[model samples]
Target: MTVFILVAGAFTGPHVWRDTAARLAEEGAEVRFAALTGLGGRPGGPGETIDLETHVEDVVAVIDAVTADSGGEIVLVGHDYGIHPVLGAADRRARSIARIVHLDAGMPRDGVPALAAVPDPRLRVEVAERAAGELPPPARDAWPRWGSTAGLSEAALDGLTALAAPQPLGTLLQPLRLTGAVAAVPVTGVLCTGNGPGVEMLQMMVEVGDPALRALADARVAFFELPTGHWPMLSCPAALAETLIEAASGGGRRLTAADASRPPAHLRPFLLDVPERARERAGNTDLYLPDGPGPHPAVVFVHGGPVPAGARPTPRDWPTLTGYARHVAGQGAVGVTLDHRLHALTDYEFAAGDVADAVERVRADPRVDADRVALWFFSGGGPIAADWLTGPPAWLRCLAANYPVLAPLPAWGLADTRFHPVRAVSRAGRLPIVLVRAERESAEIAATVEEFLTEAARHRADVEVIDVPDGRHGFETLDPTDGAREAVHRAVGAVLARLKG
Candidate 1:
């Protein structure tokens, strides 16, 4: 038996799920509805901070309340921002959940913040404006073109709206930590498409030009495309419910690569159910040991943004960090790729705790040749790598970074970050460094690394910069694209040669 738990998102309540939940119940499937803390009728007292932890607890409490049988694992269905709290709850209730279904939701992991993950300027500005607004009571009808019933009579819309309460500011304010949970449970996305205005709105907001979507398509997860707008539960209830049941019962068939190459379905992330074997967390970090007999040098590639490992369906054909690691492995070094906690688009650090953890974990790898292990970070991962290179685990031998945000710019990190590579190379100890900058990348990163190297020469640090043409910040792993795969392959070969010689 499988249990279903539907978690609501911002400006929504359990009522939004009333129709879908009722249908699932009719199928004799056990279902529960939960309102996020400070939203959907459960309001904190005046002056309550309503932080991220509080929202997580609200979901956890409901999970614990409903799972009285312990006979089955709960399948969590999250919509929109609800994905954050559900993910946090999943970590705490990893043992209790069978799988997670992200219905047009934000699926960032590793304490990454959602606001940071949104790349569209218009969307970013829109969310910021909404976030900054004072509390407005969220009503169902107020959702505006969210579901099929959006055009329903005024009375019905008002009824639905009345059921919703003001969303807590904390849900957006707090960062989520989900390294353990995502590793334990599988995640699936039920992508809504352009069937109507409601679905179109969601497509415009979340799916259109989303980096997450591209990342998802790159990962071969189980994805079912609903050509409706954001509220398929209301617009396409039968199809929505059918898909949910199919997912819960493991009845959905995998799409052929040919089928996936088509339009809407082709671009969608593969929706995969978590395998039963992955239900346990042997180690939060995944260290891929070489098949060779002797101790091998290992390099750890830290991911950027805030999505979790299982959230996106990474395709084997895709050019990605993992693809590069595979390249590294072919070169004879054990490639260790870790899914960092802060990369989950929901995590933010008041201190450098997350960065410190990544360094410690990589250095601890026995096969890594702690004395020789180097870091290759991308974008957000660069600053964290710098902290490690300059701060702790001072035994790092060399560094190879790509399209890295190395400048100690405040939005990304501290100001001194521009000088971190220099400091790591010049002051604490001299280390060999290979900096990969995209031709189209910001001149700031190139200028910063160059300035540091010149200054570091006084301390005699070795630094070399390679600018690859036609490359973008995330172009490396988007294999089958253009020059990214070839560039990455060449880069990996160079790293291997450097290590071997």
Candidate 2:
């Protein structure tokens, strides 16, 4: 018997698949059901972004555990927005996923949110009103022709009602970023036709008409259709199970336009083919223009450790810390995160004018709004930030540090004399300097820095101290933990606010 991991669509928990699981079992296929976080029993954790990432992680964790016990690759079937998590999960664990089936689900496209794939105007409006609440309606009717159901039975409606749940706002709003890993996975689509009854009718008449279902067919994903309504698991469980088994079998049939129309929305590949003009420079700097439009404000994100090594952007780090850059642009500001040279970015070099040169370079970029240039740093980069403040470029508006290692510590073999926080503050010529520190950090370490700031203040320096709750060193480092990211967000926010002001 083949093992199948079934994922339910947004707003639904595993309970929606009870009948399907039973039917699959009867057909000799071992079936397991899944519910996404914020939808099923899984509750949202503190500071959770309430976005696609949370949902994707939920499916990935489940698949990893299931595949471990199955001792081999397993078939993963997704329904509705469940396809988002399934495709993303497949990217990370492709080896363990043998076949992926979209059960009346939308496939992943770069930049397109799952909700954009829905075809019905009324359904789209309902999903949007439930999500953004304030989004204005489109000028044209967005509904599709599919699921113009002949009808459904009262009993089927009753069953669907027993199964449906309120979907989360985040599920519909968050955008999915597809990588090459998802593109390579073999996929199959199952489309349901004809209306069943009650909740089943609503599900078919609304969800089956989604543009994503048809869009999947255009991408050459294998497709099959069932002449039943929305809740086929309830109305035609045996038939849906048979189709799944057939798709799982070696030869999958092709899908037709008669099946579903392709969605106008398409995923642009995620990899940013860095242009020749944005080439790696100075043997230490790495530049990036994150996906999406911009006359974005430019801020250089100086990595804390490793020269040039700090230049390479880690995928895990990009979504968290640098998310602020994207946020800034969305707020109508230009944001640029950069890699600074590790060895030469010392107090002397920073003071000598490297900071000013970098700021000028950022201003030179046409995409950057030169008036909004700032410097953001973390840990080891903190001192560089201090020096930049002390000797900033003509256009540098502000500087912010996250748990900066500015407190003089001889343990690392660097004298407090060369990297004096107080001295750096004194040199900034009174530019706005924002310092954020973790409340949980050692008092001795933070106290020394505070004393320096106090001294700087006595000398009339523009310094703002924000004590981040439960912060730690390198708080800007994005981890699965909470407070760190929020601290980074707060720090980035401060820098952006000062520049925009």
Clashes per candidate, residues 3 or more apart or on different chains: 42, 14
How far in Å is the alpha carbon of 130 misplaced in model 2? 6.1
In candidate 1, stretches whose alpha carbon ends up further than 4 angstroms from where it belongs are 116-134, 137-162, 195-220, 253-501
Candidate 2 TM-score to native: 0.43
Best lDDT among the predictions, by candidate number: 2
lDDT (Cα, tens digit) per residue for candidate 1, span 1-501: 667888876667777777788888888788877766666646777777776688778888878987765556688998767788788888888888778887865457676755543323334455567644234654553343223332245564576566556555556656788767465576567865331212222232222234444434322345666655456665666677778987775543232222333423213321221111111112444454555664677676665433334534422112354455555665566565555455332243411464446557656656566555666776545655556556435456567777775544312224323335445654435456677767755444445556665765677656666766765444442223446555656666666655555
lDDT per residue as tens, model 2, 76-189: 888767888788788888877778897766456767787765544345567676633222222211111222222235665554445455555666677877676766667887
Ten-residue stretch with the least lDDT total in model 2: 263-272
The lDDT of model 1 is 0.57
* Candidate 2 structure lDDT: 0.58
Position 27, candidate 2: lDDT: 80
